[model samples]
Target: MAVRPILIFPDRHLSQPARTVQYFGPKLDTLIQDLMDTLRSTPGVGLAAPQIGVMERVSVIDFSRMKKKLKPAPCQDVRVLINPILLSGSGIQVPREGCLSIPDLLANVRRYEEVRVRIQDQMGAELILTASGFEALALQHEMDHLDGKLFIDRVLNLKTDVFRRKT
Candidate 1:
């Protein structure tokens, strides 16, 4: 597995909805690994297959490195979600979010404070889990990619909610 180049914003591929993962095998595993490698190489906590120009409903999230970014976060080391479906979301939080694909832009996007998702693991095994706080936000963010939606798309007001990185 290798770290794939992330497609920048405005790439047509980024706006296209991902196809469901109908087959699980070495390719899927490699995609997951590449996502993990790419995510670890960057400062981001989650990555979607579409970010790498792979229009597959797959994503990887690792919150271990975000300990300081979100206090009291109970996130696991890493999660591989294939064909993820948001079953239910509760509460609401407008967190300032950034995307690796979007580069320097950040936005205050509306997301669920807690979410329950039905997903398939790397092995194609179905599982359901609930997440809250940063984990929940990350889940929602990545899930959006599967539907061709970016964090900026969730911004209530583009003029007011979006900001550029200070750097």
Candidate 2:
């Protein structure tokens, strides 16, 4: 597993819908490993295949530390999702969002406060999960990449809703 360079905005591949993984083969395994490495190396809570220039429906998220109780604990156990599909979501909430692809920009984007997702694990087993709060937002944000949508595209207002990162 190795860290891959994240594709920045204006890269044509970032706007293209990812191709679904047809088989769980060696290539898919390598991709998942590289994604995991790259996601952990980055500062963000989650990452997707398109961000790493792979046009596949793959993502990894680790939101355990965001919960009130888990705040004191070190985050381990990153969840890998391959070919994820949002089953449902509810209760719209506007959250401060940022993207690895669109660096240095943060935006207020409306996302589901709670969501149920169905995805295939690294072993190609189907898993269903219901997530809320920051985890839900992270999942929705990463899944959006599969459909060729970025958080910037969902910004409520460019003038007021967007912000620049402090350096």
Candidate 3:
């Protein structure tokens, strides 16, 4: 497992839709492990394959620890989702979001307040989950990468919703 460098914004690879994982082999496992390591190293809640320059439909999320501190919900272990598919999410809410790819830029983007998602783990076991609030937002944000969408694409207003890097 290694920490892969996250691809920054404006990269062409980030704009292209990711390919699905055809085989759940050792290479996929290595990718998953690398993603987990990279996500944890950044101390981030979620990460997508495109972020690490892999054009595959893979993502890992660890909102358990963060959610526990922010809410009173029961927390679970870290979750790694590969080829995640968003099923549904009800009600839209604009949240201020930041991206590792975008660096210091932050923006307000519209997202669902809650969501239901289906995904497979690193071992190819299927799991479906319902998430709300920040967790929901994070999942939506990461999943967007599969379709080549970024927080910047969802920015409510470039003049106001998007912010510049702080030096």
- Per-residue lDDT for 3-115 in model 1, tens only? 89999999988899999999989988888888988998998888999999999999889878564454466556798889999999999888888999998899998888888
> Lowest-scoring 10 consecutive residues by lDDT in candidate 3?
67-76
What is the per-residue lDDT of model 3 for residues 4-63, given as tens digits with 9 covering 90 to 100? 998888988788899987788899989889988998888578888988888999988787
**Using Cα atoms with residue i matched to residue i, what is each candidate's TM-score against the true structure?**
0.95, 0.91, 0.90
List the candidates ranked by TM-score, beginning with the highest. 1, 2, 3
**Using lDDT as the measure, which candidate wins?**
1
lDDT of each: 0.89, 0.84, 0.82
By TM-score, is 1 or 3 better?
1
In model 3, pairs of residues that clash are none
Stretches off by above 4 angstroms in model 3 are: 64-75, 165-167
**What's the CA RMSD of model 3 in angstroms?**
2.0
Error of 3 at 59 (Å): 0.6
